[model samples]
Target: MTIWLHSEVGHNQDAKKEVKAFNSEDVFTTPKPERLLERILILATNPGDLVLDSFLGSGTTAAVAHKMGRRWIGIELGEHCHTHCIPRLRKVIDGEDPGGITKAVGWKGGGGFRYYRLGPSLIVKDEWGNPIINPEFNAAMLAEAMCKLEGFRYAPSEDIYWIHGKSTETDFIYVTTQFMSKQMLARLSDEVGSERSLLICCSAFRCDPSQFPNLTIKKIPKAVLQKCEWGHDDYSLEVKNLPAAPPTLEQEEPDDRPANSRRKSGKGKPRQASLFDMGGDQ
Candidate 1:
């Protein structure tokens, strides 16, 4: 068995020092030490492995993962995502952060990360209590949302207006908030050709369903309402809005063995979890 001393893996106090070094004015209340994360990563992963932290409090996991040369994704709901996480990660990328396992891992830091914000819910109720597509969503956003509902991959074609997404090489989806007339449908049907199939989603359409065998026409809001939950937005897993109680630390008996007495194991390759897999669980 191997032993990890505070000197090797660090403790909460060390985490405080690291956060304070980056943001002295507003330190995270409960942060994990970077050395602790380093040890976890060293055991569980290798360079280029993806690391994911769902409840990324102060972005310690991401920062440490980046320093250790692992790809990382961090999800945060609170405002600290803008304040603390972004700045701390910028320092890590620019090789400005010298604290934590930066020295031990020799992390000179050269990497980048993408940030994406979730848009508002797609379906909302109108004044008459009928389900309608949320006005907050623009054309592109509506197209993407419809693609997901219909089990199609959201990839808008650069050359074709009718191709918003695809289910197969021959099957495609088109989304528009405009009212589609029979003439418009005929034009689209002609353009789509006989070999390829297209799923047309619109606000309203005046066309016979049997006329276009290659095109499957569907109306927005109505077509998607039965597929997914509507008008509910709070997706957090927290049971309550109350502040979490302070953690109680367990007292341990004093160690009689020397601090240098510890065991190290050789690196092993374990299957790493993807960010998508982690997100799906949540």
Candidate 2:
């Protein structure tokens, strides 16, 4: 019942307007991904069940739900409101056309969703237009920011996969993009870090080796960056050659419906989950 795709778009710099990579006919730069909607629906709800998308990027969730015959509502606050969300959702409702996944899922498509926009990113500020700093930030504040920016959630007690003696709740980490000071590190480690954890660095290395006897340092993607020109775009054929967008594909209906239900042509019957997994909310 559910699936997901990445959030991205393929814009034509020359045109300034391009359909998204998944559904070229339905455009959105930061689409939430129809597959994510599919997976969510498959696990959480059934046909006629209601769904909600708080950060409705390009209304991908709404579109997927509509095509699946589910009632859905979306909340978003960004350029997508008109430039992307509305159009993408319209395409879904009309079952106009789409790429691979929707077609594969067999969406016969006759449903709709409601859209709404709330405010803005909580990290932003109002009229003064200046970023509000946490004057009294503690370990938690630093942890959350560091995690959010890096696409990881900060946790003080969880140990991630560092290859050294240090242990705490973290996978791999770095100081914030703005600052990577020892003071921040000390706070994160709860101060007395006689033994440092594994460290990965993109630039020059710092910190006294004696101070962190337990630390392990590993360079990442070692040769990938070195082989390419520094600091500029490196659209290697590996990535640049991806399909312009998902193929202009529509889903195919399964042939298992009963003849009486044939009058319905389809049922947005949400999918079932795999045996080994719990189908956690996407």
Model number with the top lDDT = 1
Error of 2 at 54 (Å): 1.3
Model 2, poorest ten-residue lDDT window?
Answer: 263-272
Q: Candidate 1 on 1-282: residue-level lDDT in tens?
A: 388898889999999999998889999999999999999999999987778898999999999998987878799999999888989999998899999989998989777777767679788888998888899999998988787667677889999988987765567789999999999999998997876778888999996967877778788878887776544777564435523322222332333432112110000111122232322221
Kindly list the per-residue Cα lDDT of model 2 for residues 92-209, writing each as its tens digit.
Answer: 6566645424675786545544433332222323368544333454444544443333333344434432221111222234432233345544444443243223333222335543
lDDT of 1: 0.77
Q: lDDT for each of the candidates?
A: 0.77, 0.43
TM-score of candidate 2 to 2 decimals: 0.33
Supply candidate 2's per-residue lDDT for 6: 42
